[model samples]
Target: MLEQTGLKVSSRYIAQIKKKCGLDVGENFNLPKSKNARQPQCTPEKKEA
Candidate 1:
């Protein structure tokens, strides 16, 4: 439908929309790159002795 209406979904267009909507402009802005990407204190839970 988007292609038929000429309102397509492209990387450039998406980036522009994101910018207009005050969203992140950089790639992987909201996504995690790794398991401990944002976790500075990652640790495993301890079991009872």
Candidate 2:
């Protein structure tokens, strides 16, 4: 978007500024899981033979 304003800035600098400004443009950190990620499971212990 800065290109429209004729402003020249690196993406790293823009990311830093965005973080400082508390913008929600970043990935959603509130999510507890990610897409395509597998869920955890537990196996029961075997009884004595």
Candidate 3:
């Protein structure tokens, strides 16, 4: 909307301004963590009988 009025600003700069105003800024990274990965990354290709 501001751009329509001839005002140009970058997203980074907008975040900086919002932060200065004590407002929530930046993207939400609330990713759900996976269950415990107790299994080892490497495993035997074939289990010896």
Candidate 4:
């Protein structure tokens, strides 16, 4: 994404930033799981209440 913005950043710099933010810098870091199904939408009556 940074490349699309014409900004060149090294992996080491990214790792450093992640370390500063207390995030894991492991090569096999696992992202949090997301829901596979979409959430049910609220009805108009519910919104009015």
Candidate that scores best on lDDT: 4
Superposed model 2: Cα runs more than 4 Å off: 24-49
User: Residues 1-49, candidate 2, lDDT per residue (tens digit)?
Assistant: 3556544555445555566568756664555565876533322121110
lDDT values, one for every candidate? 0.49, 0.47, 0.47, 0.53
Considering only N, C-alpha and C atoms within 3 Å, which residue pairs clash in candidate 4?
none
What lDDT score is found at residue 12 in candidate 4? 51
TM-score: the better of candidates 2 and 4 = 4
Q: How many residue pairs clash per model? A: 0, 0, 0, 0
Q: Could you tell me the lDDT of residue 14 within candidate 4?
A: 60
Model 4 per-residue lDDT tens digits across residues 1-48? 255544555565566566767989877364446758443444334323
Ranking by lDDT: 4, 1, 3, 2
RMSD of each: 18.4, 20.4, 20.3, 17.4
- Sort all candidates by TM-score, best to worst: 4, 3, 1, 2
- Measured by TM-score, how close is model 4 to the native structure? 0.44
Q: Which residue window of length 10 is worst by lDDT in model 1?
A: 40-49
